[model samples]
Target: MRQDAGNRVPDRLTSLLLGGALLLLPALALAVSPEPKTFRDWMAGCDNRKSCAALSLPPLVADTTAYLRLERPAGPDSAASLILRLSGDWKTPPATVELKLDGTPFPAAGKAMPVTANDNIATLTFQPADTAALIDAARKATKLSIAAPGLLAEISLSGAVAALLWIDEQQSRLNTPSALIRKGSAGAAPAAPALPVITARPASGTLSEKGGKALAAALRKHIKQRDPDLCGDDASPAVADEAWPLDGKRSLVALTCSLGVYNASNAFWIVEGNAVTTAKPVNFPQNDGGATNMLTNGEFEPKTGRISYFAKGRGIGDCGVAGGYAWTGSSFVLTELSMMGECRGIGSDDWITLFRSEVKTAR
Candidate 1:
């Protein structure tokens, strides 16, 4: 997939949970705001003094990057404008100047504007029709780049300005309060304060071999309850893996459920979390002793980084299988399990595989 940086919205669920928390608790939310002492403010200050040339102009070079920052004031009828303070040496003063709004070429109407010799600064006033579309386009841009056909040097944008612009646009729609409330009535309940959202870190510490055996034992017990034939006297083609690094802080444990008869396997990794734990499972494709095929499905948990699933086998080689490791801090909890290696004279057949895994903090 072609990665479009601008089009990517950070994972939706993560955004929702984080955004909800911020909306509910503004004070504690991460705020993006512009600084009071900015280039725009400096320009305005200089203009008020009626001495534009007094401001020192920053140098601009050809094929170099440059840009201006802007923020629309909050409110519906706020005046829109694109203000750029140009600074650079002009080799050949072009007869006419052209402005591109949001990467779209704009039609030039006026003659070339003169740049002040002392300050090398020039301001281009955009018309109303141009301002609206420009403002709208700017609000959607995470990063803005500006260029003049033959200008050089680079410009740096302040994050603060970008943040302020975003805030202004976001608050614009809520400029007026609703008038549907009853006369002299108190408003609806106040919004809840936002809460801090934290993701659970993987567990640390060394996993006890004994504990791994015990977890596998517990899983086998659970599996037996569902299908008595699934667990035999010996470890039923299923093996367990664990990660317990020397740090002794976090760990991972997994149970491999393999269907030897059908040539398929599914491995489930149990992870640790602060409140609720999770599991990660991986599936593997099964090739017939040269005859059957296989398919599988699974689920993933973003917050805790876990996946889980079951596999079914059919058509000599048709079966579901998966296997993968869960990163548990210092070491990896690896697993490899599958089904469908043993097959006699072929015939279409079916088999069902079911399994589950859970995450719990180290006790």
Candidate 2:
């Protein structure tokens, strides 16, 4: 009887092991399948020196797209590198992993590699032969996959052919970088124009009419392409649409095309010392309603020098938020974002102070 009990233990363990192996069969089959319809756009480009690269996202379970870049050597002598820039909470455990490509067995595509990490970025280096194989598989295969123990990344090869061709042209400089690659001259691509320097406003005194006009002109010149898209063509016509005063004798200038209630866009510039720079809301709400949910109207408190704005809640009539900010020498820090949701009922409202430095001093 004791011998039978010992044999039963071994049989139970074998059954459990078999069940686990059966569960992994489907996942292994999926890893080799050719159908991959989840990947979005594939983008490839090169820098001025003809160093080319390609970036794309694998099939993601979430709505966001995290890019993984494969870069080739700039010239004939440079080394190859693969970069993965991660965001939010997506990451694999820090360990050495073997990457199998195109359904190949482990070490068939490449050896076991340790991924180096820097903050939110992970990098891996490769030889030229492996790099060429990667590009080739990207161009020809229907589905390119890289599998590790806990991570399985799959990218659709729909536009990879065009992307690889673009990379080739970028490296050879056959034609100026454009939408497509074609045979052309062999000279260097022309240098791109430099971005203008934005000056800061004076700290001691308010901007005079001439200073304000100069600063506004610089702002318009720098944001010409962006301004038209955001606020339309008539934004900041002749002069700035609105201007307000802030601490340190500075001014806040606003540019807008639509003054009506809905679908209106506005850009802001802050004048300090003798320069004007773009400024964003210190605390912008991240909600399903988008940018319109942020605090729109802003005003400076007379006695406290604190900046305040109107913050709307998430839904149509969920609540109203009163947001406040204080310039702390370095940045406009959020002081408070208080909400009052009970419109016609007797429910209690909620008030939360994000930063209390200015509030503590005021008290």
Candidate 3:
């Protein structure tokens, strides 16, 4: 009898193993199938340069506000190449522009450098060594002031640019203190408006599977031309029943969709109207922890106008990236995707799948 009982143990174990394998089959299929890449892949294909060309510099306006504009080409790297363009009337360049970073004066001995002044334009190029000092100075200045022999121009820094500069400078101070410096402000550039927040009625549309597939195909073609790594062999399609609300008015189509890198899943809702519209993703930090992606949940106010979304990528420990988006008339526009934290041992290649999508109607 004991021998018989012992034999049953093996049978039980075998059955359990078989059942487990059966359960894993669907997941394995999902992992193996091809999927659609992200809008980033599409944008990367175009001009990923984060220079003045990419920036929609506000229309030239005549205002007393000091203008300090920085330009740099965008790339998938740590530091951004900064081209500081200052415009204003200075009888003569200041003896020495004292730049403060995060409230402390940036170290000049090994960090800060003087910008080249041509005509009334003073240009400074920031290198790796000067990255930190530049970031620090930007952060410390609650009120950015340009002090010269008889020149004093003060302008308040705000919006995404300010946040970006502050973050860049802070990181520099912490990581590479020898890189970066604060150069003097440009004479009267128009103050940047606060970043726009999305607020709209929940959008609903009926997108035919055929139509959705066609749209996806067109977008994929456009995206892959620039980023060959996108979708790759794992491109497939999956749809959702309802649109994922970006805000009260605008919502992304999929609540949980397949993007080659990992499963993009989240719950979304709207925030305050006007000045501030925000949404948070629910399923963040994917199961394996390799899928570190966050997207802002909101859309533009005018339904037919522009749409925007924010995305952050982090996974595999210290490696992370941050950026956002704005929709062009036809497709979405990709903004800067800055590498933050330690981006080592990080795996790329994320994809997306849309199975079912339809526009909702006002009831």
Candidate 4:
């Protein structure tokens, strides 16, 4: 559930509906990496390294909680990992886990998987061989039955096969013996790709509370003058401005731009853009197909010099966008991020990880 951050290609591509036929367009690039795919009740996606995840969609029945995540790194010999979680009034964590495929016990006729408790969550581990067995079991199973302490649910396997197959194709494991669902002697999938590296300058410098308030107000006025449509009378009356030094000469500034009933958007820029330096907007990491420079509910941290934002799509907090960036001295770099596409009933706390990176101070 935690990752450095990734560019999640939109889950579903836009298709134009014709009178009687569906018109398809070329696959476009929304971000640097591949897009996540939706099949039935499953979502599958992979990062730059070919490491991929196939997750079970939430139940259609509102107010029900059941989720399963299958993750595997790219390579010919990779280990499979499974994380099963649920949200409900289940008093205590389950002591054992049991699974059935198509109403029949699998992996073991009647044996139960031991569960470990941690922070009120249950855990189940499986060996690579066991994972292989489960994948093989899923090939013909129509429904996945899960049982545990204070938890009992049946997750649809309708799209499970398609999702896993998609992952195989994405990781170049399709038709290869290494593939989870598809199998062939074609060859092993290429090694997992390395994550992109971002060398950032540690965040530094802080303005006095009064200086910060003053400069923030000034910047807000400046932005309003330059882009009235972005911060006009119709925009939020309240303004916010915060500054953090990226270097001795230039600093990063964030100011309030627009506001919604449930979210407030902030704009970021280089503090002193003028005859000496042109003030330009900084594009932050995003996956929700929104503006990068203007983040909703954005905040700049002085301690880490990192800026993060969370945009709630609704007041109930069922869905929205969330991400953080590190100052690279020259620009903000995406460090950690996650997103939940549909509000449905999925908790806001479980944004899917699209991209992740290993960041080091460039100094």
Candidate 5:
């Protein structure tokens, strides 16, 4: 499972003793939309354009994956529903499963469905209210465990809060549906600070000498500290003629290192605050039978608030691709991609003229 990298949100919300009360609560109606926006931990999408959101948990020593999804159909929908999808791995599936949050039984307004197997899927459906309860439990608890006749597994509640916040942001519900999301809700979820606004500068036709010197210095420092074997000197004549401001305080510097005419590598870095930190370097294809990195010609678009780069295809007939990444508070996300005819050369104009396909996230 992929790990989330950021300051951990504390679980401070209090939970009600609703094990019995929830059984009598009614469901809440909700909506789903087609191709809705998504974050790292949450997804908002329609199986076709209604209001739906989903949270997936990394399994803990389980053979199958698990998902918690909420769906509210369009207008006049009586109630929203929460559904659980589990991987089927049992020989004799259980008829019911109980959920626990932080060692306490979680309230459920509806009964769990019998474990149905379709190929390898196990499904459980609950009334919309139950889904709301589960989401709330997740926010305030450290762990969530599912218990069944022959299965027992738990999920760490590390990313649950962010996932739910993403959902609320999409619907503009402001936590109206679940008390857990409200300011005074039992969870008492702390308001997350706004992400630093990263603005881009108007593209300058050329890179400044100061920027080039900074880039070369940063790369040499990185090589000396991280990979002395690949680079013998930090004073090599590396140049960064291409520079783009990522924001008022940060910049992106593109650089290339050539081993020879047949061996070369290209990479870029993010200069954060006033310091340049070690960055992940990308390797480009060389004529000397080496694996190639597709990313090149990195630039930041001020109007779109996105960083883009040219990417060449690996396969002989594959098209050239343009990739764009959006800045999340903590990291970058690949949110835009475009494909064109074969990339005969990284800078060939013919490739751009032969646009084939594109997909972009709705900003």
Candidate 6:
């Protein structure tokens, strides 16, 4: 049926809008895609540099403590690295482990796999060829088991496919051969982006014991007046407020903000000369792209201008948020930050790296 010019133009405009929306579907999905997304039994996260890592979690068995970390940086030439780490309460650490797929012995995949062992931790790094094969099998297999005489770690591959596919999506390798889940004969992906760098200024000057106490007290009073709602006095005042000299006229002070059973928050400030009125909260860069002043169980090192914070998830400190910063005279920059959202008995040092920077301190 022939239509009028006005009707034809409206129909054409609707068609164009729908076509554009179809083309933008993928980008729209990615725009709101959650970083550190959880896919069933697995968790995947990509850093700012498009360096993706997927962590595998084993079944919740007290005796079994092991997981796989599949990491690949964004680049055509970059290859995937798979590390299987095992460390938990056991009679003795296993010297080696055998691979199994769906309850069957998988010696072919384990052949020539590099093994590193110590008293507490044992790790196996799969070869590049084996890593490719392992990823292929894991995407389809139900379970991949790492077993020894007394140790066994059963990793469920429920969402292995999705997690790997998300990594490929984040790295723009969806249809390329570099993709872990989906592979095609597409051309090379873009090179890995350069890392962010942070230059640290060394803190100087000295603070006597009495001077430190007085500075802390003044800063505490100033904070109470400035942000009274923040750090109401808790009964646990045993942990004394601390102060470190940042420079000749400026000093950094930490007042015990709040205390918990397993964690403590410290309010930091930079005070100039003896003017406590000039004290302000330390503007620390946060991982989520903002500035914060609170640090949990933090301490400062004057020589290196380093300040670190470690908030344990539990008393055992198996999982939590841990990071450090390097002072840049005017502000503190985050050098590294990682988080273990789950307290799955994983070591504190094993948290997933979310943000990292090339830190350069004064020589």
Go through the candidates in order and give the C-alpha RMSD of each one to the true structure: 21.4, 21.5, 22.3, 6.8, 18.2, 13.3
C-alpha-based local distance difference test score of model 4: 0.63
lDDT of 6 by residue, 1-363 (tens): 111121110111001111112100010111112336778888787766788888875544446677788888889888889888887666776766788889766656344344677777788887777788778787568888877777767778888789889888888887787777788888767887778788888889888979898877776676677877666655354256888888888999888766667676777788888788877778764323445676777889888898887766566665556778888887787676665555565665555666667888876
The residue ranges of model 4 lying beyond 4 angstroms of the native Cα positions read 1-31, 62-64, 118-120, 232-239, 260-262, 273-278, 285-291, 315-318, 344-351
- Which candidate comes out best when scored by TM-score? 6
TM-score of 5: 0.36
Give the poorly placed runs of model 3, Cα more than 4 Å off: 1-66, 70-74, 91-96, 101-104, 108-113, 136-141, 160-363
TM-score of every model? 0.25, 0.39, 0.27, 0.81, 0.36, 0.85
lDDT, model 3, position 134: 51
Best of the candidates, lDDT: 6
Candidate 2 vs candidate 3: the lDDT winner is 2
* Residue range 293-343, candidate 5, lDDT tens digits: 223445556445455654333322122344445544333444433333222
lDDT of 3 at 285: 26
lDDT of 1 by residue, 2-94 (tens): 111221112121111111121010110112111122232111111111111101112222332123423333233344344444434556432
* Candidate that beats the other on TM-score, 2 or 6, i.e. the better one: 6
Error of 3 at 90 (Å): 3.6
Per-residue alpha-carbon lDDT of model 3 for 109-188, expressed as tens digits? Answer: 53344667655555555565565445455444444444445544443443324434333333332233222232333222
Model 5 residue 123 lDDT score: 68
- In model 6, residue pairs whose N, Cα or C atoms come closer than 3 Å (at least 3 residues apart or on different chains), thus clashing, are none
**Best-first order by TM-score:** 6, 4, 2, 5, 3, 1
Give the backbone clash total of model 6.
0
Better of 1 and 6 by lDDT: 6
Better of 3 and 4 by TM-score: 4
Better of 4 and 5 by TM-score: 4
Q: How close is candidate 4 to the true structure, as a TM-score?
A: 0.81
Query: How close to the true structure is residue 189 of candidate 5, measured as C-alpha lDDT?
Result: 23
